[model samples]
Target chain A: MSSSSPEQLLAEIRHHCTQSWTLMEVCGGQTHALLRHGIDQLLPAEIHLIHGPGCPVCVTASERIDQALELAARPEVILCSFGDMLRVPGRQGRNLLAVRAEGGDVRVVYSPLDVLAVAQQHPDRLVVFLAVGFETTAPATALLARRALLAGVPNLTLLVCHVRVPPVLHAMLNAPQCQVQGLLAAGNVCAVMGQAEYNALAAEHRRPIVVTGFSAMELLQGILQAVDQLERGAHRVENGYRRAAAEQGNHAAQALIQQVFHPIDCQWRGLGWIPGGGLALREPFASLAVERRVAPPVSAPASPEQAQGCISGLVLQGLARPSACPHFRRPCTPEQPLGAPMVSSEGACAAYYRYQR
Target chain B: MCLAVPGELVSINEHHDPLWRTGDVSFGGVLRQVSLACVPEAQLGDQLLVHVGMALAVLEP
Candidate 1:
């Protein structure tokens, strides 16, 4: 929108887009940035910046939403989750927001703390919070779960859908066609895991792992650094966002996550299975875990319904980009999104539609 | 899973990681991290974006 912008620098970068540099951004927020600002068009097509499966909604398997719906419809269960999960269709056009519309007592709370107040107010209602998100969100959920235990609020229970950030990164690196040379590491995930984890990734993969921010300047600089490293045949961990992130991430939050959840192999939507990639509530908190209480997942994926055909899985896995998807805009607009990635405010395709051509 | 931004210190506790902090960060929702670490000297209303569990960086908001 102005002169002296990153646009001026774009042409120069494009010239160096390299014979083969498969650079991917590992956060869904970054996907929105690349698409929203039309940075995808601004950059050289030779440099493929694929969207990673960092979007929590995009990766949330079908069974989870079914459980949310089932629990929401229960008279005593007051389900709470972030706003994005509402639009995602689980089975038979049903979503948590739909459950709420049907008057099953579903409310949107900005923070996990809000659930605490709801528990305080309702005393008798079995308020089950649908806690879903990545490391950034895990702390709040962990804190609330702890608070529920300490306060002896038998009515308040959290259905943890918290996932880790690093294991997926590891999965991406190990893919067969994984020509990935670098990554714009999610700043927030790094904030929790700290710079320590990336050191191994960078060394193992021999790629520059630039912990990048979501700003225009931050992303531009991050791309430049990533490109620069690849061009020079260097591999290491770099911090594009150093102001808040340190060598050690939030230890207290880490401690909380450790106490509440244990690492387990979870199914990813596109990539299928990544061993030890997800987190589940610990045994001590078995009563709070939704999987423990829910009946067998009745609303499992149907044969024909299984093929949503959003291509978000391929797009997220870096095998395909949003523009390449024939259904990107036609079938999967943000308002009537066909998949979880498009449903969220941070969705890449939605951002591209709103800001990109 | 978590995304973090950086913040400045509003007030700190010599005994605990700062006890209180207040800042309007760029993140969605009324985001606040009640936890603090003493190694990173912070003051009242300093901004920090946190993810998973660590405070990543101070944002220029």
Candidate 2:
């Protein structure tokens, strides 16, 4: 806890709550933490918490999943990725796990570096690590890229689907369906990308953007800060998680990101394409990209379709809650996820299905 | 997902090239090897923001 404890922060939030305000927490980790600790229930009814598209797994474009499924199906290639991404269905109800069931060499690893060992052991096979995350995890992937390059690990390649926060936030604010008045930005993203990018967005949108951590007390403190700004009619970027994040974030990390990757137009599953929304390998490392090395036999990319009656797109845009989805609890439990939101551990629907409901 | 937590830097493995250094970070009792490439100034006993096995920033108490 900082100077103020969780109880004090909650009390201050209650005292400052004079009117109804809709605030969105942009990180799924924070969303789950809030629900887990019953912090949302502790807040005054005047404050509404809207979930944002901060879960990387939930926002991963369906086409990329199709591509991953194709790559994983290759007999000479060993596909590795985070655990949460394995079960998400892509097109025609096929996921990486399904490919694994068919004898595809799919392995779950905690970190990207773990893929290096697999590459070293199986020198004859191509080891492809699926890099999917925001700025918080980009540095790690960037480091891996550099390491693989330095080691001249010809057998190792990366399938990068790294997304940035600013452009996506810009998209949501410009969206007509979005009703968010204030935002609690993901602290770890700020810990890497810095608070400078958020300053302009907060100023343009006239909304308080507070960089927040993923804990009940830290989240409550962040919400309180957002509410205070809303009541005072202030639009500024604030740092509630000052312990780790700074105005000018880790510059070394930024430099590493600059050296390793470049931005490109990226398609989000529900939100569609955002200019400069995704990161691609730089010139020197382009040769180490899985997409560059592997050419699928298919003539065209698979056009994935969203399952009918799944309101995951609406839920991601904050237009509807998880419970509002017809199949949220019925046909779309964690055991059998109908959409990415239900499958991702940090997903809003999964959080609601597990904690809120 | 931009989920990261604070962990204590238990030890630093210095490479001939400083930027390639790494550290063993302990979150509660669980330990993981994290790249110190981002936070080159990070020292032993410093709290770091570990996400996806990379040290993003140093946490000052």
Candidate 3:
């Protein structure tokens, strides 16, 4: 058999799509990649690719954004976070970017550690870092926190939104609307946490979870591997990203994360709280925890303006597709994003908008 | 799993807040982000673990 193109793969999958498969990619990066590469359009109409809330910005609750904004407003605190997270809306439809526009000391940083250094060198400013992302990102925050404490960077604090992938997957599997036969796990997260966590989930759920790289070839491989497992009635964890991920992930990073963070309840945009699917800075590093210092004061914790006309939450939950949203293009463009998915570079809406629109 | 490799910090430049000084780390032809905030002592050419735009450490050369 010759190697398959995404077009070829989609054509073949369409043959079985009508009655059988619903492969969900559990990372927003994959969602962006698929849509940006036009992998979504290349696919046969029969097969479905559901987007997951792997985007740190898309899944982050409004209350957290408010807290970040509040931190940014303080004269001593310069709030730093991933750029896309800056645009995520809060209580009154305000976001970090909006707050920045209003002259708050908000800075966009690539890593949690960068803010730590700022905190260390400045000594005068409180560098309250907005820590976001999943297990793949938690390590950096953990390492940064440890480093800050070691360096006596008392001015730095972490606004942690570091989420866990496995528990969310577990929640999805148990959700009433759950409709997945296989998974394309975000490869970066596995690089930090390893594929071992997935093994137990696979054993329990009897669903194939293919750890995948961002490359198109790796994605194709992951999809094919998941299909093969489903076809063979075999449920297990497989790594299509072997070069970067091992059965045991980055042990050093894991050790850092374990030392600084403990599982806690986190609010997801659509999925709500999954009890222990998120992280909080442990007692030793509690000083770096932003959640402890700030209280989010949103009149209504759940606000509709925060969503606007965007059905991204539904798209993330697999209830709908980006194209399926009525306001996808007319109202939701990347420059003027109506939803968080359009706001972030890793967002499916942004990817689809940039590539397809 | 995309190859999230280690990058080397060359130098930092900032007036008020410090900017990351990590070298251009090639990742499958796409350059990734690493934070230069943690490695306070990282001089030019100090290798660091770069992930999702954050530098995790001053790694082995």
Using TM-score as the measure, which candidate wins? 2
Tens-place lDDT per residue, model 3, A1-357, is 225576565555554344467788988778767776777677655556777778877788767777787778777778888778877766556677777787888887766666766776777877788888888788777777877777677777787887888888898888877899899998878877888889998998889999987767777778777877887788999988775666677666677688899999788875678778888888789987765655654454556444365677677787876778888888777776777777887777776777874
TM-score of chain B of each: 0.38, 0.92, 0.54
The sequence of per-residue lDDT tens digits that candidate 2 reaches over residues A152-217 is 889999989999989999999988777999999998889888999899999888899999988777
RMSD of each: 4.0, 1.8, 5.5
Question: What is the C-alpha local distance difference test score of each model?
Answer: 0.70, 0.87, 0.73
Give the better candidate number (1 or 2) by DockQ: 2
Q: Sort the predicted structures by DockQ, highest score first.
A: 2, 1, 3
Reference-based TM-score of each model? 0.86, 0.96, 0.84
Best by lDDT: 2
Better of 1 and 3 by lDDT: 3
Per-residue accuracy of model 3 over B1-61 as CA lDDT, tens digit each = 1224665554455324333233454444565545554344556666655676655444444
Question: Considering only chain A, what is the TM-score of each predicted structure?
Answer: 0.91, 0.96, 0.91
Write one digit per residue (lDDT tens) for candidate 1, span A1-357.
122568655755665567667788888888777776677677776677767778888777767778888889989878887778888777555778778888899888767767877988998788888888887777677777776776677778777767777788888888887767789998777766688878988998788989987877667767877887888888998888665556687676677788878888987655678788788888576667766655645766561124766676776677865667777778668777766666776666665666654
- What DockQ would candidate 3 receive versus the native complex? 0.17
Higher TM-score: candidate 2 or 3? 2
